[model samples]
Target: MSRPPLPPFTRDTAIQKVRMAEDAWNSRDPARVALAYTEDSRWRNRSEFVVGRAAIVAFLTRKWEKEHDYRLIKDLWAFDGNRIAVRFQYEWHDAAGQWHRSYGNEQWEFDDAGLMRRREASINDVAIRESERRFHWAAPGPRPADVAGLGDTPE
Candidate 1:
């Protein structure tokens, strides 16, 4: 199955792709999110190396289990040919109720079919108090239209 906004992306399409990904991740459904990648997709998320959709699903399952009430935002950083780059932030609390915000940059390479074949991400986390949270939208949902993006502030 081919995903839309296929490669050789324009500015608008790249932005659309980024938002689509952000929305899918916000859903926190591992199986649903795995469909966006190729069957043999490869990923480097932080220090972990994962390959294939099944592995992706397993990885996400473990992740969401530990990251309670996760919310995410992704901004398109650049795109060319079949590749796109993104900068993202996400907030989640551990089982112990300590909140942490993660900042990351991802490089994605998609096949002609628009399924991501390779992904590389580098991320860092900073602990924050509950009151310091910037993303206040409901969990497992898209950011509201009224909510500002990373570009809106110097944070």
Candidate 2:
């Protein structure tokens, strides 16, 4: 099955793809999110290496379990041919109620079918008080239309 907005992305399509990914991730459903990748997809998220859709599911499962009340935003940085770059930030609290915001950049390479075949992400985490959180929308849902993207402010 081919995902829409297939390769050789233009500005609009790239932004759509980014928002689609952001929405899926905000759902916090590992199985649901894994469908965006190829069966043999490979990923390097932070320091961990994961391969295949199953591994992607497992990795995300472990991640969401630890990252309580997760909320995320992704902005399209660039795109050309079958590759896209994204910059993102997410906020979540640990089991101990310590809130943290993560900043990252991801480079994605998609197959002709539009499924991501390879992904590389580099991320850093900064601890913050709950009151400092910028993402105030409900959890496991898309950011509201009224909410601004990272481009709106320096944060």
Candidate 3:
């Protein structure tokens, strides 16, 4: 199955791919998110390594469970051929109600069908007060158009 805006990416198509990924992740639906990857997708998220869609689904399920009120933004860093790199930030509170913002960079490699086959991410989190949160859209929703992206302001 083809996922289109299929590789050999132009600048515009790459940006569209980034936005589509951002929107899918914002939905916080593990199944929906996993669908963007190849059936045998491999990922390194922080120190954990996960392989295949089933593993991806399990990992995301655990993540969203611990991270309450999650919101994320992803900006295109670069792209070529079937690879795209992204810089991202996300905010969420834990079960104890401690708020944190995570900053990360991800490198993605996609199959010819435009499904990501490998993803590597490095992320760090900083504790913040709830009042300092910048991503205040409704839970499990996309960032609205009026909200500025990471490109607009230095963090």
Candidate 4:
């Protein structure tokens, strides 16, 4: 059976949800990240579609396996009623020590229960040097409360 009607998506809630999702992803725990989505969550990251939490888990597992030392930072782009759009930049190094930075945008749709039901994203990848890195959130502590909108803040 198909999923039910989507909830009233708004900018605020969407940003909040995106924050939690980012946290989970940055944690690099596939299972934890999958839990934020609906059981049948559907997603397209750079054109590949993966449905359901199981697939999300598996996809993330395979993703992290190939991407070592992954770190991500997502910024809020815009938000309507029930949908929130985001622009993000991430850094990761491969097993061979090749550093890369990816720029992307994501659109998210949430269900009534507050679980994300659908996500669409487009990303562009480029190789970069270690000195070009931006997110230096290194001194390990709690992440900012509002990471999505923390554009140039000390976050």
Q: What is the TM-score of each candidate against the true structure?
A: 0.98, 0.98, 0.98, 0.83
Candidate 4, 1-155: lDDT as tens digits: 22222346556655566666666788888897887788988999887899999999999999899877777877778876557788887778889998888888999877667677889999988998989866556422224554434477342
RMSD of 3: 0.7
Model 3 regions more than 4 Å off: none
lDDT accuracy of residue 97 in candidate 4: 93
Q: Give the residue spans of candidate 1 off by over 4 A.
A: none
Per-residue lDDT of candidate 3, residues 1-155 (tens digit)? 88988998889999999999999999999999999999999999999999999999999999999999999999999999999999999999999999999999999999999999999999999999988888889879888998888998568
Q: Each prediction's Cα RMSD?
A: 0.6, 0.6, 0.7, 4.2
Worst 10 residues of 3 by lDDT: 146-155
What RMSD value applies to candidate 4?
4.2
As for lDDT, the candidate ahead, 2 or 3, is 2
lDDT of each: 0.95, 0.95, 0.94, 0.75
- Per-residue CA lDDT of model 1 for 3-114, tens digit only, reads 9999989999999999999999999999999999999999999999999999999999999999999999899999999999999999999999999999999999999999
